[model samples]
Target: MAMTQTQRFGIFAALALVMAATRIHHSTLHHFDALPDASWGVFFLAGFWLRGAARWAFPLLMAEAVLIDYVVITHLGIDFWSHYCVSAGYWFLIPSYGALWLGGSWLAKHQVGLRLSTLALAVVALLVSESLCYLISNGSFYWISANVPAPRSFAAWFENLGDWYLPFLQTTALYVGLGAVLHVLAVQVARLAQHRGQTQH
Candidate 1:
């Protein structure tokens, strides 16, 4: 049984709201919460359930992320460039997230075992997604201030990389762990819905 376009939209919209709300509290408190954020799940499910519609859904997801972060930055009085840094990071990471989601969604079809697979996907996502964030913000830092770090010594470069990458790695790990759980749940719900639909017919 195939999911209808309306069904896909409803699923994606609901997931987006979940993503937004869950992140809001954590971001406001400057705390990285362990709740599952649905942004990547939305993008993944949107692609799996909606196909071509995912093109629009992915960008809209990114836009929503930027808007939410912007509001938080304003409320927190963080530098505006920080907002830009995050937005750019999300922009860079979206494709990696999308690909991860797509891969997981594909695995779902085969009833591929969940726990180990989910962890693997989450790890892959954490690595690439966080790395992208580090790269984007590192570039931004360099652009804003030259001589930020010299590659003259291995320790110097390592410290510079750590300054940019460590926080992102922690955040991504937390976010992706929750996301993996949510992805598993979403697939289950969709399966139940499909089963029910078949019964109704």
Candidate 2:
């Protein structure tokens, strides 16, 4: 979809806000747990909604993610570089997240409106992209990061991948599912308004 500059900025701001709010800290609010990090979903939705802004939007979001992580880690009195999650492998997130963006972009290019076929395509795209992303991020950490002890083997890596894959997949799916629902609602409302205008005419 062709979005005006204003629309692009608005969507960018909203996605940035969601990422900031959810990425800052994992905590409970009024007996309810906070939402999981929305970084993965943000990139996917940004690709779908602001495909034209990929040149700048993607880098900005990546920077935001790093900044948030730095702040959170430093606040806890830990050195950023020495942190468990920060390593040479951490740089692999570029390709990891790029996978998601590409998936969403492909879906946006092929989608023909709200239909089961479109939904099916979206699910497939998300699964393939997420799997690739997990491999890049998880594999990099397992093989390159000092965080994982020596004696690394494919069997061990595969076991590690199995241990964390579902939670990450579920989190991404939850946010993407919400985004899909909102997209449907917005499209339906626009169609309804247009229909009413035509009927009045």
Candidate 3:
């Protein structure tokens, strides 16, 4: 189903809020340490629901992510470039997040309905996209970032990947899964309302 302009705006606003709220703590603040960043899931869902708005929306979200990081890092009285996460590898986030967006876009294009098949397809898409994103981000950080010492190797990189992969994957899956549930519930509610209106008429 094509989303109306109002629906698009609503989704955009919601995604922006989620990115800001979650990332504020993600970057530096330990106060909200329990809340993992929703960036990966946000980009994925944006691609699914706001595919038509990609020309502008994708860039907007990317800007928002950077802006959020800038604000948080600066607020802490630290120089942005000097921050540990700010490295040559940081630029790779464009392609990393793009991988997620494309995955969701692929699923949206191929999705038939809310069936088991659709669920299976979504799972496959999520796994593929997340893996690719992780590879780009994690591999770049390990191999290219100055933060890692000069003695990096495939053996060490593989071990480093293992250490962080599960946490990132689990956090992303949690948000995306919750989004899926909300989507299902919203669809059912809309259908019920429409059916009641028809019956009344």
- The best candidate by TM-score is 3
Most lDDT-accurate candidate: 3
lDDT by residue (49-116, candidate 3, tens digit) is 88878898999999999999899899999999889888899899899999999988899999987899
lDDT of 2 by residue, 1-201 (tens): 356899889989999999899988741111114578887888888888877689999999889988988888888898998888888998998999999999889899899899999999999989999899899999998899998999999999999999888877888888999999988998888889889999999
lDDT of 1 at 185: 88
lDDT of 3: 0.87
Off by over 4 Å in 1: 1-3, 22-52, 74-122, 144-157, 164-167, 185-201
Ranking by lDDT: 3, 2, 1
RMSD of each: 5.5, 3.1, 1.7
List the global CA lDDT of all models. Answer: 0.57, 0.85, 0.87
Quick one: ranking by TM-score, best first?
Answer: 3, 2, 1
Model 2 error, position 107 (Å): 0.4
Alpha carbon lDDT at 58, candidate 1: 67
TM-score of each candidate structure, all chains considered together: 0.55, 0.93, 0.95
The true-versus-predicted C-alpha distance at residue 137 of model 1, in Å, is: 3.5
- Each candidate: how many clashes? 0, 0, 0
Instruction: Give the poorly placed runs of model 2, Cα more than 4 Å off.
Output: 26-34
The alpha-carbon deviation from the true structure for residue 137 of candidate 2, after best TM-score superposition, in angstroms, is 0.4
Looking at model 1, the pairs that clash are none
